[model samples]
Each structure stands twice: as structure tokens, then as C-alpha cells.
Target: MKFIHIDKENSIAFYQQIMSSIEKAIKEKKLLRNDKLPSVNKICIEHKISRDTVLLAYEKLKKKGVVKSIRAKGYYVRTEDFNFDERYFLLFDELNIFKEDLLNSFLKGLAGKVQVDTFFHHFDPAMFSKLISDNMGNYSKYIILAANVEGVESSIARLPKNDVYIIDQMRNSLKIYSGIYQNFVENIYTAMESVLDLLQKYNRYILIFPGHKEPYDMVTGFEKFCREHGKNYSVIPDLKNFKLRKGQVFLIPNDRQLVETIEKCNHHHLVIGEDIGIISYNETPLKKVVQNGITTLSTDFSEMGKKLAQMVLKNERKLIENKCTLNLRKSL
Candidate 1:
């Protein structure tokens, strides 16, 4: 087969470039069905590159079903239909941008090793159970970045012993395991304390949230901080009908409605959860929100990606739980 060079100094690896060229050739019928690939040594000698490079490229092409290696024979273009899913099981709050980044980081971390077959649909215990039931035997590895263990614990508990690692959230702290990050009540408390430290100066705080779980954690942390600091507070769920009198700070959860409400406020100051802050959770290249600026308590999602890479390489398959950092930004 003939090979062509597009851009030798391109950012992508030369082997990857070669692989792309050959795959494209196959698609275009340049390399007919069952065509034999250039021998690894020959390709290396012709390309003036290392044998490992050519072998690595061929291995990757084999994994994608673009080519296959035959026993006692060289690799050949796959003649049969190549069918496989390319998505992974990603579970997180749909409304949370940070959660999306965290999942992306985990998926990107696994780029070459295994393709993400499909993302597990929004946090549904039954859906995860169904996936495990249907594809457990088919899938060689399963990576889950569970934000809430209690939500889907029972469902995931039944899967076969495959490589499993929790990214942003943890199950419990008693056991030693590997993870990209950790989540706990302490971080929640820290987040609340952060907002309260600001609220104490103002006296009244407005709290907005999409649901009760995260808010509940923040409230526990905030109230605990307030009680220790000799301050009294009240929660006003009705923000529209409610009017801030004086010296009151508003702590809203990361929600679009709450975001719009904060935007409309003229002089009123706003604060989000101190723990599990929205800013701390954006772990992907995709930006979740375009805000003036927002403070958050988040974890290093790339580290989570690194940990995932380690787990997949080491074949680490255990339920891991981790948390995020209290990343502070200026959205408040």
C-alpha cells in the first residue's frame, strides 16, 4: 500500500497520522477487503521511524476493528462489518455544569484504552441496573463517577467484579482505595462556613438551590457554622414574594432560575453553597456557565482523569469515593 504525509510536524503523533491515512484509504476502497498491511519492520524502515511506533499504530487500528492481526501472519484490513458502541456510563446531575466537566475529564482520561460505549442516562438507578444487566458481560471495563452513592448504590452493587472507580464522590472512608477526588460532609461544612463568613457581615442571606439534597448539606454546614459563631438565621424558600430588608446575604444554589434571579437583583448581594460550590466542579474543556464570575468549592478534575488512567491501566476495579475542593470564585 502507498503512504502519504500531510503535515509531518503536526501536533498529533506520526503513528496516529499514519493510522488515519490507512483507515481513510480503507474507507475509500484504496485498500480493498482483506488487504495485507505493510509489515511492521518494512513500515518502520520506509517511514524512518521506530518499529514500536508502527506496532502501536497497528494495535490501535486493530482495536478499532479497522484491521486485525492473524496468528502466524501479519495484520490485514478487517473485511467483515465493524460494529461497536463508543460511549461510557456517566452519571451526574443534568443541571450541574461542573458535573458534566467531571464526567468529561474521566472520559477523556480513558481516550486510547477503551472507547466510552454510552453514557449512563441521567441519575437513574434502574437505568444503571439495566445497563449492568444487559452489557456487563459485553463490557470489559466500567468507570463510574458517582456524585451520590446512596442514590444508586443498590443498583450498582450487583454488577460483576469489573474495573470500577468513583471519581468525585466516595462510598465510605474506612477502606483504602484509589480515586481522582473525594467528597464528604466536611467539604459541605466548609462551603457553608465560607458563605456564612460573608453573610455574618451582612446579617441576612438569601439561599437558592435546585433541590433539597445539596441545600440540605449546605444548611447543615452553614447552621453549624452560624451556631458556633453566635449568629441566628432563617431560611426563606419564597425568594420572589420575599423582600430582603437590610444586612441580609442570599445563598442560592447553582440553578438557571436562581442565576436569573441574581442577575435581576439591583443592590442585593448573593452567595452560593460554600461546600460543593458550583465553580469547583467544572472538570472539562466545555464551559458550563458564562457568568460575571462565581466562587465555588471544587476538585481538580484532571487529577481525577489521571487517576482514571491509572485505574484502567492497573485494572483497578473497586468502588472508590472521593471529593472536591472548595474552589472560590467571584459569582457571589
Candidate 2:
């Protein structure tokens, strides 16, 4: 009946000690599913611990899906699996091939008692807020890929600032929070400059930016790169109205437009990487072979994931820029 133990001399926090004791009880078969845990008052009086400490531990277990609290009945063990060191709630704009890499890498990099629940907002601000509101206090950390979503600062402000992390695209409002983000403006500028030699054969540079979910900083970077190099350049909202010509290089952000660009090139009877060049944003394994290789400007998603794991594991409070790289291929 008396399963919980307290060690006040230990350096661990009181709440954490209470959680560890419960986990130890579960692991040793002393606690079973549906078994009622010691009451907060009983725990406090017997162990000389504060009521808040007992409640905090119970709440953490409840959030981890290990314990459930009933109205007037008190807390009971919800499951037999007691491995719950940390829980992370990861939010993304959308799940695509590249983002899949980021997610898988983050998951693979983490070891031990960790649970990651992933969700996507699909660029809907309402869905974004709803997800945050729903999972507000359920996780130890909140990792969000807050795309071009506007007015998220107010929503994120409700969360514990130290526990929230901004990923992918960072916003000015959430700059105070620690994050691992892509430097879109500088990455695009430098990546383009890196392929300047490949660009010399082309007469015009065009960026296919649909401008919906895509970051506007990309446009600024491309514009800056073109102006400094004195290269004739333009940004098109879509390929529906624009005509692709030979001796023109197109920088496409999304794969949909990239495919359209290639199709248009075929209609014009222009050869790729020769008569017309193509550069796409984000790198994937298929990109290496697609269109005889599509030149890509991208950040290392795998490394980003690994670094995020480290940040959480160490409880780091620094904003880190995930390394960006340009993968050169024949399409350019």
C-alpha cells in the first residue's frame, strides 16, 4: 500500500523524486494498472513533502499517459509501461518528404524514455492555435515548425517560454525563445553565390515562388543575390502565366512548380542543365537523380534533428542555426 519513497538528500527536485518513486514502483510490479496512487495529503504527511510536489508528479504522470485522475476519486495508474523520462510535442507546418527526414532524424537521435507526438498545421493558423491550446501543458517541450503562420506570437506566449522551441522558419515575435531554425535569407544568397559559375551560361534568373506557405525571406535573398551580381532576374508567382525560355535558369521552391518547369522545358524542346537550368529548394535522395539531378539549397535536416535532441537532453537555452548546405547536381 505504501509504495512511494522519498529521498530528500538527493540533488533531484522533489517533484522529480516523487515521479521517479512512482516509476520505480511501476517497474517493480508494486503498482499495477488502475491501482490508486497515494493521496496528495497522505504523501505529504507521511513523506514530509509538500502537496504541490505530490501534485506536480501526479500531473506529469497524467500527461505522460501513465496515470489518470478521476473527479473526487483521485489518481490511479493508467498503464503498466512506466518508461517516461521526457515527453516532446512536435508541431510542423506540414509533413512532406523533406520534413519527414527532419522528424525521423529527430526521433532516431533520441534515446531512453522519450515520447514524441507529431502534428501538422498545414499552414492554417486556426489549426496551429488549436493544437497548441489542446496540448498546452501535456508535454515537457514544444518543438514547432511555425511556417509563415501569422499572429502565432500570442499563442506561443501562453506556453512556458523556455520550453518552447521554434524550428524551420523563425519569427520575430518568438525570437526570445530558444530554437533551431534555418537562415532562409542568408542560405539562399550564399547557395546561389556558390553556383555562380553554373549560372554564367544563363541569361536570366527566375524564382518560382508561389508565396503562400513559402518564406518571403527567400525572395529577399534571391533579389539581393541578383542585384549584387547584376544578373537579370525575376520572381513569378506561378508558371501558369509565365513562359520558360532557353538560356533561362529557374529557381523553384516547391516540387510542383519544379515539375511544371521541366514540362515547359520539354514543350520548348530545350535540354535540361544545358539549354535551361533548374535549382530547387530542399534536398532529398530522389533530388540527386531527378531531372538528371536537381541542384538544391537546403539545411541539413538530419543534423538539425540531432542537434535538437541534444538541446532537449541537455536542457540548453541557446538558439541554434541548423547548418545549411548547397548540394550541386547536373540540373544546374
Candidate with maximal lDDT: 2
Query: Model 2 TM-score?
Result: 0.83
lDDT of 1 by residue, 23-101 (tens): 7787677887788888888877777888888887877676465676776799788644444422234444343555555
How well is each residue in 94-137 modelled by candidate 2, as lDDT tens digits? 88877888888888878655888899899999999999987776
How many pairs of residues in model 2 come into backbone collision? 0
lDDT of each: 0.55, 0.86
Identify the runs in model 1 with alpha carbons over 4 angstroms from their true place. 1-100, 146-151, 171-184, 191-199, 212-216, 234-240, 267-292, 317-332
lDDT at residue 185 of model 2 (Cα atoms): 84
